[model samples]
Target: MADEVKLHGLAGSPFVCRVKIALKVKDIKYDFVVEDLINKSADLVKYNPVYKKVPVLVHNGNPISESLVIVEYIDDVWKGVSILPHDAYEKARVRFWAKVVDDKCLPALFKAIGSHAQEQAVAEAHEQLQFLENELKVKGSKFFGGDSINLVDISATFIAYWVGAAEEALRITLVTKDKFPKLKEWSDNYINCQAVKDVLPPREVLVGFFKSRFGKA
Candidate 1:
């Protein structure tokens, strides 16, 4: 029998989008179970008891939680397209950058959008984004993964896609071309990629969601 793969996720979630993009890149066929996060499905809780989150990847009978973890698990199990680098150093570098995106960039972005002290939070987000801008300049590639999308690019999906929606909804731009030229270019390249474009949530949907969630600023 073919391997059974199921992704429990919420619509318009960047984390879930990462897994979808990886699956598309590898041509892996799977079922997507859209979960209503507020209601908290039993299967989602059962699959990921600790976090009880959306974006749980259940393969055959086993389950994998966390977006990045599930993405790495997909890369490890699949063949054909490679989501991570072959060299040990390069692989480590990619992992390091991915961590920065999650640990540094993501939190800063959330603060910029949601915090009461908007000015300070936005400044912090810009500081974090500068790191990515410099990394892109140094790499001198269309993506962090050189010619193709990889774990780093997938991990930074939120910055490329969701940020735009957040900016639109909030009427405050955090990643402008003037402040982050290379990152702006990279975002253009990323969202336009066939694989990524195919899997991304609609911009309007995301914008509306953000507007409803955070309210207009």
Candidate 2:
């Protein structure tokens, strides 16, 4: 199928998972190509020459790199319920949250997982999560965009699954129910939603992998 859509991604990557969820939501069928990040496939390198990363979207042979960029491209091309809001201001807000997920939340999360200054890293991650909690409070929305998932929710897909895995792997909890009730509720909702549940990597496997990669806290 030369004209079929294809995706290059790595297993258990939340960035990649974002695309999967969006494609499922949009009802767009795509061929998924799992890449070996370590070895780096020729096609993966060739298609995404700049970043040389996975989660590349090949639509009828045209390649698009970066997960969020690919997701937006998907939304634009497909005809369905949009991942972004229709209103100009609302769309900007969604993009803002998405940027926060990529620039702040994810970096803080990885820092908590892999940094030597464990306590400081955890505190920093907590701060970022708290910021998101505030956003939810201000919007008074169940999920990032509302009752249904949207681009902001998709952008923070890691929080839905990988955060718990990282917590179990490290023996430290960042998203305790007490500290982040609304955030925790949102996380539960996001993971249990039909669109997200099937695509999530098993928590046990994620925990094991992270445990081996980062070792016990």
Candidate 3:
């Protein structure tokens, strides 16, 4: 019998989009279980009891929680496409950058959007983004993975897509063409990729969603 795969996720979620992009890149056929985070769902709760979050990947009755973990799991299990690097050092570097995106960049980015200390938050976000800008400049590749999307690129999907929506909704700019040219170029190339484009939420939809949460600018 074939394995059954289902992704329980909320629309416009960058984390969820990460898993969706990974699955799309691997050409995995799976069912999408749209989750209402407000009410929550029994299956979502059952699948991920710890956090009770969306983006739980259920495969053949087993559940995997956390978006990055799920993406790694999919990459490990599936063939044909490679999300992580084959070399040990390169793979570790990719994982390191992915963690930086989640731990350092994401918090700063969101805090810049929502924190009361606007100046401090924005400054911190700029610092974090500068790290990425430097990495892109040093690598001199269209993507963190070089020539294609990889785990690092997947992890930074929020910067590529959601930042624009957040900027529009809040009438602020975090990433600018002149300020971080390499990062800006990377975002353009990443979002325009066929697989990435296929899984991304519509820009207007994301803007509307962000507006609803943060109030109109």
For residue 72, what is the lDDT in candidate 3?
95
CA-lDDT, candidates in order: 0.92, 0.88, 0.92
Model 3 residue runs over 4 Å out of place are none
lDDT of 2 at 139: 79
Instruction: For residues 24-87, write the lDDT of model 3, one tens digit per residue.
Output: 9999999999999989999888889999997999999899999999999999999877999999
lDDT of 2 by residue, 1-217 (tens): 4358999997788889999999988888778898999899999999999999979999988999999999899889897878999999999999999999889998998888786337888899889989899998887887897988899999999987898888888777777889988889899899998888978888888998888888844
Q: Rank the candidates by TM-score, best first.
A: 1, 3, 2
In candidate 1, clashing pairs total: 0
- TM-score, candidate 1, is 0.97
- The C-alpha TM-scores of every prediction are 0.97, 0.95, 0.97
What are the per-model numbers of colliding residue pairs? 0, 0, 0
Q: What is the lDDT of residue 206 in candidate 2?
A: 91
Looking at model 2, residue 180 earns an lDDT score of: 85
Assess candidate 1 and give its lDDT: 0.92
Off by over 4 Å in 1: none
